[model samples]
Target: MIRGLQLSLNKTQKLRLESALEQLESLSSKTNTNASVAVADTIPVNYEDGVLKGHGTSEMEGQVVATVCGVVERVNKLVYVRALRARYKPEVGDIIVGRVIEVAPKRWRLEINFSQDAVLMLSSMNLPDGIQRRRTATDELNMRTIFEENDVVCAEVRGFQHDGSLHLQARSQKYGKLDRGQLLRISPYLVKRRKQHFHHLDQYGVDLILGCNGFIWVGEHVEAKDDMVVDQTNKSEQQNANSGGSVGSDDQEQSHTSLEIRQNICRIANAVRVLSALGFMVTVEVITEIVDLSSSLNLDIHEMLGAEFYVVVAEREAERRRSSTKKR
Candidate 1:
């Protein structure tokens, strides 16, 4: 796990990081006993009742066996093994962050860490004008103006196509181009689908988008726009441009993000990276705690990636889980 990072570690720091990780393993084992199964492990099942086996399961000699190393999940009469480390399995209405890979006619292909690339059609997303008009030839020609290749985007899982192609949508201002930040990838299983995926750390001027497909976005915060206000603003900007009243270069120079906000963004992003490295479920509260811990210790932003910080994070998570169990 430590090898995944490109950091230089001293003997003492390496030893400390290993020890902390061991403690975390010990704690998790106690609470998650029998919840996880290895490959070929027999899953206890009722023989008489109806059984609906799902993915990662196979039947051998009247026994349901796991074909992957993962946790066992049951729903009604259905049983499946969710692989601990596998490509994302998308569902309708899931919010995801992905990079644009291809710009085809009327559609964009995004690499969303799934079995296949996801499609974001021009017709699926809201236009810049905030209008619901049909996609025209002009729209098709100007698709790149909206989202060019390699642009990071936030969108919803529209659904799978008839041919099994995944589709995405960004009809709301809340979902669109993301910039001025970092993107972190982790195991999809580490992030569960939740009602709230977008978190704005207003105090730090950062936004945390926990994409269900394990593509995490830690970037400068952007305020959501109201459709009515956006339309009015667009009209005014157009009027100004027509009247030869474009904003001056001085105004444009002052539009860059502040240095303090950039530092905060880096701090929050490192917090996320640390949690992911430790195999902990990354949540907003835990991320905030990590940031607070670093801030209280006066640790520099880059120091957060050092081995000592990783060790501290693991130990902190262990203690947190232990205390949480005690409360339960």
Candidate 2:
């Protein structure tokens, strides 16, 4: 009936329609908060009223819904993730990978990648039981035999102390004494965002643990027979070949070898830095790729971390000198 002309709404009808549209929009957008005031007239409220304060679940209210980017979980209100993933704050009964930096009579001091060093008490550990219990004078003398400085270890965060420092324990079957392996240190944030602890490289015969303290262990799943002998021989050969340079030693041979190593290391570090910046979780394959690239550049892997490692940068300076020579 009203073909050519439109039927205009009264003021009340227009208001009702506007309110209905606002509710519909809110419903469609999944905005849970109830709007008490008129939809259009209501001032915008901060949307991030529920974000987590730190990195994990908070008892505190109004936390934003920020979950860990990678595979992670909150178990019994405790958060855990893999290495090189983002990290939540530490909680009691958390297992962590740590390094021994200091040793004392009753407890050892450990670097667990937290703000403070954790204490590993002698009593908390499952040592030889009663009477045969307590470390003897001989055992105390050989503290290095039991645990040495720079020894990367795995332990559990038992609880906190009155002073707020963490207490650690290695009293489980899975915990304790790691043998020959390569250890890597990374940022803690990367660990909190991952799900698993160990990533098995079965084909490579390698087993790795991404420690919460940024320490990762990479080595053969099973200890290699005679690996110590092989390592020893290799070390001896390298040292013997590098020995004794007398006055004005052109050192050109050593310099060349060292430069090669530094070049490879720098390239790898650069690649890792790039990937890390891009939020890519670093893996052994990533490192291997960098090494492969270095090989393509004619770099020697054997020279990596060797005595001549510093010479690469030096050679760069030397090249500058040569260019200046040409200019002169």
Candidate 3:
């Protein structure tokens, strides 16, 4: 009887439960069990308001006792799904963040926080013209330009390979190269352990670029004029700063200050490793606050490690998957 689950056993279910418990005990004893407990929805369970009513499977023999944690509902002698408390492992169709590490001729291998890098193929992409096509010589030459080493792109898991490798895709419009921003990396296990997926930051006009490899980007949109001004000012300021000289123009000074702030964003984030362990959704506000406190007060935030960056990466991945599914 886990804290959230109600124990309901029928004649068949009772026997199954007993066997499962025995197996669990044996497995636990043989090896220190690191198995994550989760509710088996496919297995027959009937419960109402924390009371067991009926069972799903009649065969009790060889069934393993599985520990489940969910809102207890009892009906007859069984327990059904009330709600999902936790889940383990990434599934097909799950939009995850990953990094491109190796580029093979037919496919690109991605480090998806799993045992192996998932493969993304040239055939997987639907070209800008909306036509599905194969890899071309031009595409091969442009492959590095499209997705290089250390470049983070949002993609979908097509399926698992025969050898347990993941098959991935980035065909749709939303899934592509991310640029002009800072990326924050966090752990995948921690991200899945948390329930809430969508962390919105409508307040700041900043956009979040999320990757399963834990790399995330937070940046604001810049118009053409703004881009030119920023580039010019940045170059001027960098030269002056390197020469140990101050700029005469206030605009240059302001640009210098902004660049310094942006550069420090990565430094401050990387310095605090513990922040990634906390699993806080790293929204723009959170970044801003950290910047303010650290730069102004010089207080070290060793406590706020493992924090997650908020992005529409999940939504974009989902949309891409849906489009792929429709096409298939």
Candidate 4:
């Protein structure tokens, strides 16, 4: 498991943490019988029946071998190892969050925690005006206006090009620039691919986007605006109103976030950080539960990162897993 947190614990706390981790290990062992192998380790397989090699597998001297350290999975003459800690593998239609790294002639290079920067072609995405016309040279020149460098963008994998580069598209309003949020990087394996990656917690006024590439975005929820809707009356009325009066400084005051909303964002973010440190599967359900648990205990958001909190979370997870096993 990935261990990135450094906690200063006393003797009892250390012992309890170790015990909780051991319990988690035992629970996983009870459920999964697949053997784990290291890189270059030969995977024992029947040779009489032709074996189909999958990801993380290579053939060496009539033997099947693993090129990554992970658990071996087999399915009807097909065998592969699912690597625990590897770069994100893009599949068509997978929604991913990425940062724009480069703006090329007709494409944008995005960093999505993959082996190579994924390509987002101008032709594949919709214009800011949400039109369905051909991309002209003007559009190509104005690409940066749509998505500049370092901007966080949400797009869907459009499949691979003939040159073996991954391609992405953002043709929908839901897929676009994300602002007013924090991005958290965790292990991609922890985020299991689900039907819905975009979640809006109406109760907390927060929008959560679980990127398949391990880039999680927690931000204020913004209602999706339809650019196609052209309200000329409202626009003319606003123009008339603005023409009559000078804009006051009060109107220009930045809308500051309320104290409560900021704290809620921090609490949710800390829950993610704690769960990542514990190497637990990070789902919306688990993250929400952790946030609720912390709130119920009246613990400050910063306290969630302390050694005691880590130990407590581990013990609680162990107990939860035990109860789950009993029910099964």
Query: Clash number for model 2?
Result: 17
Query: Candidate 4's C-alpha lDDT?
Result: 0.87
1-328: candidate 4 lDDT, tens digit per residue: 2378778899999999999999998999988975899999999999898899999999999899999999999999999999998889888999999999999999999999999999999999876555478999998997877789999999999999899999999988789888777888988998999999999888888888999999998887777754446574564455345333433442344236567777888888899999988888888988888888998889999999999988988998999899989999
Which stretches of candidate 1 lie above 4 Å from their native place?
A: 1-19, 228-255
- RMSD of each candidate? 3.1, 20.5, 16.4, 3.9
- lDDT (CA) per prediction: 0.87, 0.51, 0.48, 0.87
Ranking by lDDT: 1, 4, 2, 3
For residues 73-178, write the lDDT of model 2, one tens digit per residue. Answer: 3344334222224332467766677788998887789877677888987767754221226666775665565577878777777888998978988775356655
Better TM-score candidate (2, 3): 3
Against the true structure, what is each candidate's TM-score?
A: 0.89, 0.45, 0.46, 0.89
List ranges where model 2 is wrong by over 4 Å.
Answer: 1-88, 128-142, 193-195, 223-278, 282-328
Model 4 ranges off by over 4 Å: 226-255
Number of clashes in every candidate structure? 0, 17, 42, 0
Off by over 4 Å in 3: 1-88, 128-134, 192-205, 210-275, 279-328
Prediction 3 TM-score vs. true: 0.46
Give the higher-lDDT candidate: 2 or 3.
Answer: 2
